[model samples]
Target: MSEPSGDASGNDLRRSSALVGAGILLSRVAGLVRESATAAFLGTGIGAEALRAALRIPNLMQNLLGEGVLSASFIPAYSKLLAEGRREDAGRLAGAIAGLLLLVTSVLVVVGVVFAGPITRVITPGWPEGSARFELTVTLVRILTPGVGLLVLSAWCLGVLNSHRRFFLSYVAPVAWNAAIIVLLVSVGLSTSEQFTVAQAFAWGAVLGSALQFGVQLPGVLRLTRGLRLSTSLAVPGVRAVVSRFGQVVAGRGGVQLAAYVDVVVASLLAGGALAALGYAQVLYLLPISLFGMAIAAAELPTLSTLDHEDRRRVVERIDTGLGRVAFFVVPSTVAFVLVGDLVVATVYQRGNFSEDASVQVGAILAVYGLGLLASTSSRLLQSSLYGVGDTRTPAIYAVLRVVVSLLVGIAVMFPLDAVQATSQGISVVGDVAWQVAPEALRAADAPNALRLGGAGLAFGAAVGAWFEWLLLRTRVRIVFGPTRLGGPHARRIVLAALAAAVAALAARALVETIDLHATIEGLLALGLVGSVYVLVARAVGVPEARELTGRLERLVDRRAK
Candidate 1:
């Protein structure tokens, strides 16, 4: 047997996961910069919501057909072909899938552009028809739809690359997309104060960036698929299997996308800043998931699929360590977000049009999102295990359930909180958010002065849904595979370490806030303290990942000293 290729070793799993993590880290940092520039230019104003809402509608095309579907369907099937040493079959499969994806995405692009107005209305249910923001969102959607077509093809590239274990190029390709937006936003922001004009420019930049993202990965996909045959033939070897699995996974991903659409719709119904603020908070919330959860899960899927039926015991061992590794890092992230999220959010976005209060409100939403951080991260790996075993419909069923629960809970809680609007006192003009006020704002003397914390309720609803998904996923995995509980020794140590770190960090945050330290400096100091404390406590409690991290740092330091 080779290590994951044959020996079935967990070390191979860890190394592959590290590669995925590094790629995601680079891409996420770029995305963060793009979001920061966006915050500075748009703030939580109407322009921000318009851009965010516009992206939401067209992005549905990508969301349903994107990486998740490929991961669930294509990777497992395509990877199995390679594992059997059928390179020609694998190449043909990849080409056929790519051709089909291109055709489907082309159709989506046309549908989205032609029906942009109706789609915009459906996506932002709370926005009145024919409003200026609605019209702006419609225009932006037309511009962004082609980009979605490009991004879908990018996802095809991702599937092929990930199956080949060429993880970095596919994962890092998104940097191009983020970089393009950041460049355009900064350039336009420097030259103008008109939000609508900036929004229009951003749409074009995003489309170009999406093209660049796909273009960057094309060479890699082409290189690996040397015998590639681009065709939409359903009869290609393994193509039917891929298509069958793709349908099931799309069903699962579709349910998840439905929940997200509900989130946008519900937020549109809230007071002015709900959608925009939640968008900012989500950038932070999704970072850890992308870095740790997704990286580890994605790395494991191909290997897990290869090992399916041949070595159940070895596969379960891999799952245990992957879950614990994800838990070790994610626990602290959850702690930091819940305890010091305001500090982080302020440091990242409290400049230009983004006010201090808006950052704090976004922080609160991050904290709410933090409540289910562990469960959400854990669910990814669990789902991959299910996918590895060829059970897609179960996840699809539960995904629908999760969305239903999320919408019901979110709707019940969001409207009341929306009554109290949130806005910055520094802004003399009400800006463009006037059209977004909740009904109760009409009776309030100081409606704009209210804390726009309604987004937290929505976040809380999402957190609950996350945990529900995790619990269901865990139960299914246990029944199908073996014991997949995350209550391993390392997870317990991670929890304790996170708690101790949070306590000290809270003290650090309070002391730093007492002084007049700059927001960025204060955040760095506080977050640095949290990271240091968490690692040290985890080391003392004998978490092996902590020891591994310490050893790696020591090795790097020793080498640099030379």
Candidate 2:
């Protein structure tokens, strides 16, 4: 029998993409339910705002050091070292990175706990003075800070696993964290009589969940590589080099993340609930982006690390196919969300303590975020390409540009227009200007129309900045990979398959609506049925790329069976 193609490998780009995508789908679904549960329990309240602000600081650090920034640079260097037969070097570097990360994160947790009050004040200056919100925000931050250590360690483990071509375990690890959080939530009742407030309960769950995130990956990492050994030698050849490059990458990522924090700061300066609204919006928007886009990024990395010019061309072709397919699924998704977000939000969360008015506000924010879905996904792909070529500084520069542009755009767009007043006196009318330009947050608090406009502006600014980064990266890709040579007939087939997918989705939606489906059960059924239809239709369309993806999946199952 002919040996299986590299596609047959368990951690092959396509197969791992499918696996990670599926697992992430599960995680995102649970995450949605988790957010919905939280929203229902604590809608637009002091508790919810406190939870959001508390979560933001540690989560921001995680973005910088754990997944987005750190992984991009760390994984490529680690993988390259392994690919070049420097296994010991790779293991030592991994150990060193892990040791350093653990020490730094431990210190951060202590500092965050000791200085929670001042941190919360800086993060959310408009938090009502001496209120429950302020106190709770500080408390939750202290509770959640330790997660930084667990999460950072988890990222290092995941990076090592991915470098060694063991993906399933790492991909499945997030499930444990999700399960832990769910168990905690279920164990604690929603009634006010519960021992801990919902915020406190969730805070505890986060700690347990992050522990699971790190713990689950340990066995696999141990099995797949040499044992970890820490050394005081900061001068380990590749380790120092990787860390220096990673430092630059982290600084760039930190700048962009600081911009994100700026958004939280601005929103917190608004009315009481703006912080929560923005948080909910971000969580919901990231679902599809992270699920598919990050899967493609993860899958592409190992292959990109090993490929020659022709092979690299082929890999980018596969990436294009994958990205185009995502666009088809996600574009209509964006449209549907823009059209029916209010209904979806209301249906999911309107009952219990989450009122209809709150649903309307959250849904409006979601719709604004929906506009940037494609831009975000495209940026993920382009950034992966840049990292694949071992050019970290280019992306760092692009990242800084995005931060600068977004800040300027956010300011310009958020400033309200012409706050003038007029009064009539007997025969003459007199006008007195009260304010030249109303700040958006005040206008959003007092005027809902202006709030929606401000949201639109923020969303538009974000999308513009993302696309601008993509454009710059596109030029880099052209320069690096020659002009117009990535896509092939396989790409064409994937496009046809995606077109069929759109049709299948519409058909599925129609059938569900005809039956008057409602409730979570109905929603789940509709998604399942629509997904099945898309697969079947893509199969019928003779899309070889789709077939290739499915074929590898079958082989992976067969390998496990043996």
Candidate 3:
């Protein structure tokens, strides 16, 4: 139970992050495919919007009682007990938490199902009452609410597995979740004439998927924590501690969720497809955050929890390393989104009912989100570090502040943009440009205008809030652990590398525009070239991380040659 030495801890951190990242990558790829199938079947219309709203409405339960809160509270306390060699106490605490989460979520799920109509109405007041879309949303919410309860249990399993450093199985178990959706989409093809029918199919599939996700992780949790029993007692030694921390973390997560709900409410009032468009953009935006930010943060939290708070140097070192690794990957991802997001969107989703116009809409929102990629990812790591050190209140305070900033910024930007028509009249391009290939159905004069800028406004507001959160977290980390090694020269190098990659990508895009290549092919080529150029430039600028990455690639190549 002795704490890992500094070098051993760093190596373990990297290995754990790589494992989690690999698992997440597979799950995210499956998720992207699931989304593509959804778009192909439902399109970015009322059906899609209703489905998205239904999913988000019940997701409140999972967000409040699920991974974020559990990771913040349960993992820290459980890991601490293990570190102290209190195996029985840790197992009991896990069981107690599991029982408590099941009980609370069960009630919430039943109430949610019973009152699905009212909940859907409150969440999406813009939809006309008794309309097909509104009715569909209610039905879908009822189906999806039970899935939320299942996912809360899955998250508890995740908390236990993570505490024991069994990161891969818990993190990758979501493949079952995504795979189930894909199977449903493929089986129920787009031939279903009614959008509501399609939505219903997806809802049922999601419920099944949540069950599979939890089932896959249960054995691992049991193996890691033997003698685990289902106990509803909150009086257990470490259970009380976790519950105490859980409340603040839930408040923090609730603040974050409220900001999202605000976006949903505002977007609901804007246009028919506004919510759906926002959902599509968020899927693309979260890809890098999950792959890089969450991977690193999730790996480091358990290890960081074992660190003594008095060891300022070790705390600063671990946090700084996490931050740098996050920036190393996320910065390029941001540049990619800003420069070639349209091409990426077109490649991924512009087919069937998902029109070229939908790609443009999603891409524009994604570009705005790109502006805050670094900030958002950094804030995640910073929050994890705070949780590791048992300082949840600071983040909770800032989370509320972020919500206020997002709401204010969203209103200021969306209303004006909604009034202006978003047309692609002046921009002329050869080949498969987003505007040119848009379906006439999407461009019909009778189509809703609120769809044009409402999504963009939400993205902008989120970006603003994300940067504010990062700033607050950064300042707090500095005050608590001293200035990190990430800022001075290291930051400049990252910026320069990102700039070089952006230029390379832009140049590749320009070349593609002059020629007659498929947008997907052009996007892939551009991304590849940009990524290569970034690694080279980063290495030239003396970035140790970049150099280390290059070294790994070289060793792999040498092995292949051998």
TM-score of each: 0.94, 0.82, 0.94
RMSD of each: 3.6, 6.6, 4.3
Better of 1 and 2 by lDDT: 1
Each prediction's number of clashing residue pairs: 5, 0, 0
Instruction: Summarize candidate 2's per-residue lDDT along 360-474 as a digit string, tens digits.
Output: 6666667767766776776676677777767778888888898888777765654231121111111121222232234434423222321222343455567678777767776
Tens digits of per-residue lDDT, candidate 3, 1-562, equal: 5567877876887899988898899999999898988888877877788888898999999999998889999999999888888888889889999999989998999999999998888887666688777888899999999998999999999999989888888889889998888887678774675777888888888899999999999988887785588888978888888888989888888998988777777777665567888899899899999998899989999987888878888788888878888888888888888988877787778777887677777777888889888888888888888888888889998998988897889777775555433333322222232212123343332344234656787788889999898888889988887776443237889889998999998998798779988756877887887889998999999987799889999999999999
lDDT of 1 by residue, 1-562 (tens): 3544433455777788889999999999999888888888888787888898898888899988898888999999988888888898999999999889988988889999999998888888777787777889999999999998999999999999999998988898999999888888888889999988888888888998999999999988888875798899999999998888888878878888888888888777676678888889999999999999999999999987877455666667778889988998888888889998888898888888888888777887898899989888889999999899888888888888888887777677766555444333421322233334465442121223234667877888888898899889988887777777583447778878988988977898789868988878888888888999999999999998899899999999999999
Off by over 4 Å in 2: 1-11, 193-196, 309-312, 414-456, 483-562
Clashing pairs in 1: 1-6, 1-7, 2-6, 2-7, 3-7
Q: Model 2 residue 202 lDDT?
A: 81
What's model 2's lDDT at 364? 65
Worst 10 residues of 1 by lDDT: 442-451
**What lDDT does each candidate get?**
0.83, 0.66, 0.82
**Model 1 alpha-carbon drift over 4 Å, by segment:** 1-8, 308-310, 420-437, 440-451
